[model samples]
Target chain A: MKKGKWGLIIFGLVIFIVGVTFPVWYGAGTSAPAPVLDMDTPVIKSMPNKKCVEDTAFIRAHHMKLLDAWRDEAVRDGHREYTAKDGRRFEKSLTGTCLQCHSNKSAFCDRCHNYVGAKPSCFSCHIVPEEVKK
Target chain B: MKLLLPIIALFVVALLAACFAWAEAVSLLTILAYTSFLIFAAGFVYRMMKWAKSPVPFRIPTTCGQEKSLPWIKTHPLENPANAWGAIGRMAGEILLFRSLFRNADVKMIGGRPVYGSAKWLWFFGLMFHGSLLLVALRHLRFFTEPILPFVNGLSALDGFFEIGVPALYLSDAALLAGLTFLFFRRVVLPQVRYISLFTDYFALLLIAAIAMTGLLMRHVYPVDLSAVKTMVAGWLVFAPVVPANAGVMLYLHLGFVFVLLAWLPWSKLIHMGGIFLSPTRNLINNNRSVRHLNPWNPAVKVHTYEEYEDEFRDKMKAAGLPVEKE
Candidate 1:
């Protein structure tokens, strides 16, 4: 049994090395940005206003949750006003409020979302003007 | 092999996870995931190759019931498969439903009397644990695909069909926990099992349980930004990982445990998943009388031919008056 197995282990380890290094053969294409994710999209030169409902870190992590809460507030609970942590208030609607500052979505939204590979379904229901890249 | 190593191994995983959390090093998590999967896939393929390449030198099948013998005697076809097709059917049963584990029966002494009874609870929880784990893994494909496959959506819907909360309660969550708890308790309760249980066995089981618990916590308790998670996963899939700053410590902890599972799989007995199929006792056909099975590793034997023996002992045989063919 030992004699039989040792031969197999030697032959199999060689194959295992080949199998593990498969990324070397097929990973070249995957390493670069995909065609769908156009990496060189135009950048947003400026925003309508510098103030956001939440800070950058919170917005980066909890944007979807905040958006979901905002949607429930506006549509389900009939509350339109959202008071931010810094005493700023904004309307609770994706198209009406969030889109006001980040109107250039191709440059602002698509760039980051595409970079991070996030495809939010907000636009599945709501209509918005396409951002014309400069 | 001992209690200390697995505990220390688990502690190392936990400590590494904490450091990542403290540093907010989400990219490190992504890198860990990539490397973990590479090793897992490679090792899995390697082990499978080894199994496939290994030679079975004898027809040694374990027969659980009456084999094919006299025409008058009834044979149990499923339990003691005699042919290749029968073996296939049996293998299917074993793989899909764990037929061997299902056959467990406990014999015990009760008040100085011998008693035999069914031990099906182990089978039940084992099935539940494995089945729910597969379902949960399948449900997680939502993070990898774009425009979400309808089947994936359908699976998630079915898993969370209860609709109990904001995020919906996945039924597998409860089943997994119940199964793990039952299995763990049984291991602790049974004296024989407790005595034989190694630290690695407990460590693997507890690690998976912790992973499942953390997953439940993330879902029903402190739901993370799934969109952000999807983004990171999609990036990982396409070689463009973007670890979201918002993905909290819980997600990292869960992933850390999974990474450990993947890394330890090839080295551990968990590899029995692939080994069972290659097992000669389970996979071989029980038709030794009907067919000659060659032993590939049969060693050559040194022998004295009858002619040579007769020639060498002829004088002695004649003198001693022993019968000899040549004489």
Candidate 2:
């Protein structure tokens, strides 16, 4: 076998050995805790409550109107012709334009969501614009 | 040829995992977590560097449209992009829609006659597999963050739209497993694919399967304290890195397997995810005639001019009655 193949084999072996030995090093034991469902506790909920507003239809209509306004703004800002891979042209919308208002995510979204029961995963991978503190 | 070893490795790991139940032992869980983390961290970095250093000697972009020549011909600019912007657009379509795979065809011999069939199954399966996996990954975000996002809740609701179980059944967990199984079976059972299958390929599929299996086991069989697990994950995310004492062994094994997969990603065939962008065939335009592609890395070299060559071979040419530049 080539040296490279041998190296790979050795590496795989090392990984396998480590995986096997890990359980040995750390004792295998389980401790089950009582399940608690506390609704009032504000730990770290991150999702916005779509149910907070009474009228869904009104909210959707407002959202659409906001989107139309955003589309017009995008067009005026020279971001009108959004061409896709299938040679299709689309006009860009600004309604769900995350970067615009939520430039400071924790400030804009988190404070409200934390008050309710929503905790989103956006903070996990992305840096909250507010957290940068520049 | 190297396919046998990974299978053996997988079986060995699974057997070991079965032998050491995390619920029964905490030390084992810690060992597994730390070991897997180390392997994952070291392995991933090594693989990425190796890929980044690999040499590409030719421009081999796969094109499906007309070349950008003779203005009247009308090039399919997006499909076969001639510039960076067009390439980006094409890449986005490919990544998001699997456009090429969507246009895939299957050929078979039916009663001695060659038949071409629209093979949408591959595309459908690919979409389902990837989409489901994305949902599953996104769903996992609930376990890693503090207060769960409403989008995640909504996504979970949408995923378990049928609402078959008490906590709600996630279609992705089942679909991902089934899709992976199908893909794995295709590699092993199909004579054509089996012949070309490498150990690493099988290893990747098995590792993913193990992760999914462990995750499912934790949810249904063992019933882990997800709140604690989430807290632990959140700590890790926030750079605090708190190892939860209450977290189950299955979770460790699952996390270990996931870490191994991540570490293996940059080095293995999985790098194709990133390499697709670097792929000359996928990204480059077939415009050899329209534009000169001088290798950016090419060094300035002294050239042997025709005059110098003739001067060197003048005597030999004269002796042989051959025409020479000097003569």
Candidate 3:
């Protein structure tokens, strides 16, 4: 018999390396750009402070938690008002208050959600904003 | 000290990574990850090459069934493979199902004669650990992929179907932990097993458990920004690693454990992942009867032929009255 099947062994190793280091070649020359949130909506642009209910960093990280809290408070406890960190009062409604400024759901909401593969069930019951369908 | 040493070492490693992360030493962490990966890849190739270069002088397949013989006799192809196809099938069984280990039994002296009892816990735990590790690794593909694989999403949904918590708990997470725990306890709880257990074994288990715990803490307790996690990991894949502003210490600890495991794998028993395929006893076909196998290391011995011997000593044998065929 031959000393070793070098051809077959090398081929197997190549396959293993390729499979294990898939991300290296898969992401080669590819840039994973973060989703660009368009805050150019007329409602947002018209605001004097030009800010969100919470700070940008806080909202970016804990938006889901905030939305969850809002959902429970509005639905279960019938608490419809929210007091912001900046001592501002706002109605705790997705469509009525939150989406008022962020009117373009696709540009503002769907971008990051799709990028991160977050399948939020918000639209399952609530209707998608009219502008989003356009 | 064997147990305590590795535990302390792992703790120190995690602390080092945590400190680096706190200092926002993104470049250092990236360099560490890359260096460890390089070591793993190099060590893998080195070990494989070493194994390949060493020649096997004989067919030494560890057979458990009857070898091929007369036409009337039956042969177990999987257990005693005589052909390439049979060998491949046997290998598949050994790799996927761990066929040999499945038949494990504990032999004890009950009434002076040996008594064999089922010891399938080892096999079960092995399967659980490997199976759950595979699932967890697959689930992590989402971080590497740009758009994220659709099957990954489906797999995640299936794995987290129980929906025990707010973000939903993954079944693999629990299974992996249980598997690690069982594997660890088996060494300490069983006297025979403990006798053979090395410090490295305990170290590997504890390190893995630590990684899993840190990951769980990030997911359930602290709730770190997953977006940041993905961004950093995906960035590393693309050779553009950026430490996100809000990346937590838990993430660093998890990463530290993973890096250490990667670097240590090729040098440790974990190389069995690759070594399983290269094992001569399991991989070689049982074809000694049908074919000739030359020993590569056999020394060349000078032989004196009968004809040559007779030619040299024919006259002397004839004079001495000894019978000679040549004369």
Candidate 4:
């Protein structure tokens, strides 16, 4: 038990030393770079200039319709139809097929959103379809 | 059987990690880190294959509500799921909310009388730890991508809502550290838990703690050049590995710790993340009686019918003056 305690103490000390020395070593030798952006320059565009969502309900309805269409397509493609105990037959899609039609992600949404500085992280996991012609 | 091999591999990895730490050579550390990852990947695939081959003769999903029975009896279909939809709903709840664990209880002897109490502490800690870690991971997206996302910025704002530090400390980081500490201490201090605890459990907790601690130290105590770190990470992500010459040793240690954690994940109990979906109790609904569940993987076999067995015994039954099927 004593040995174990001492081992933990030593490990903690090593980590602490490493933590303390790292910045001193890295920062000391390196020359500081000039600030990339000017303070006076607008960091982001005004939100009023962005494409407005007039009706969220309309958007949701359209989204649901698209979802239903995709679901139907998935079933038509010989995907295994699972009959739920509730008597609903549904087929799961592996990758969302909406990207087939809506291929150029940036053109579809990113253009205006990027201009408005409203970038979303969805693209991190998802890739824009490169093959689809604009 | 495959699990035993990873345990052995972990020991070999620990040795290598120790050696790299001592030597402090970038090449040696990189080799150690990537090699560990390769071993982990191979082991994961092998283990998954073994699982896929394993025979499950029963539909044994754990149900919390009334089973489907007589027509007069009311069935709690959603909770005790007699069908796939209900099962899916239950699975979603289990996965998202840890529904089963939320309902867990701890038993204790109170003055020689057995008592059960809510074990919500585990659920609370688990939720906080997982949720905060996820948020932290999302917040890290800025480092990997060329242009930072608005959602990442929004999430960063939300995490640093308290605005406690000079650079505005992320609340998720504090929550994550606290949650991990609680979990680690729970394993060590709790008598029953401690008894069941293996070195692997302690090792995993320690490793995560180390990772979190290093990250905190890097951010607060030893701030690295964010742009440089981002460039290095982005390069790695794009398959163009750049070992920046002046990248802080602390960053290397942090990355090393992360790689170690990733390698350990598949082999350790952390595989529970994947295993939860595979768990018979959580995934399966209690509808065995209602539905004829034929084991799809069961091999076809010839069977002797009751009539055939009775036919052979009929002559012996007549000699003994017993009722015979023929008579």
Q: Interface RMSD in Å per candidate, to 1 decimal?
A: 6.5, 14.6, 2.2, 18.9
Report, for every candidate in turn, its global Cα lDDT versus the true structure. 0.74, 0.61, 0.85, 0.61
Score chain B of candidate 1 by TM-score. 0.88
Clashing pairs in 4: A119-B150, B61-B284, B62-B281
DockQ, per model, reads 0.13, 0.02, 0.46, 0.01
lDDT of 3 by residue, B35-85 (tens): 999999989989888888777778889999988878789999888988889
TM-score of each: 0.72, 0.61, 0.90, 0.62
What is the C-alpha lDDT profile of model 1 across B78-166, one tens digit per residue? 77887778888988888889889898999999999989998998899999998998898777766655545567777877777765554
Q: In model 1, what is the error at residue B150, expressed in angstroms?
A: 3.1
Isolated chain B TM-score per model: 0.88, 0.79, 0.94, 0.82
- Using lDDT as the measure, which candidate wins? 3
- Model 1: residues >4 Å from true position, as ranges? A1-84, A87-134, B1-8, B49-55, B300-327
Deviation from native of the Cα of residue A89 in model 1, angstroms: 6.2
* Tens-digit per-residue lDDT, A30-134, candidate 4: 333212321121211333342212232332223333333445555676554544344654444323433443444555545433322233334555566563333
Collision count of model 2? 31
Considering TM-score, which of the candidate structures 2 and 4 is the better prediction for this target? 4
- lDDT per residue for candidate 4 within B1-327, as digits (tens), equals 223444565556555555565565656555654576566655555555455446666777666678888989998876788776787788888888878779889888999999999889999998899888889877876664444566787898778776554345789999999999999889868878888877678777777777788788776666555545654554444444455445555676677777888777778888676556556675566767866778776799999986887798888878888875565
**Model 4 CA lDDT for position A70:** 44
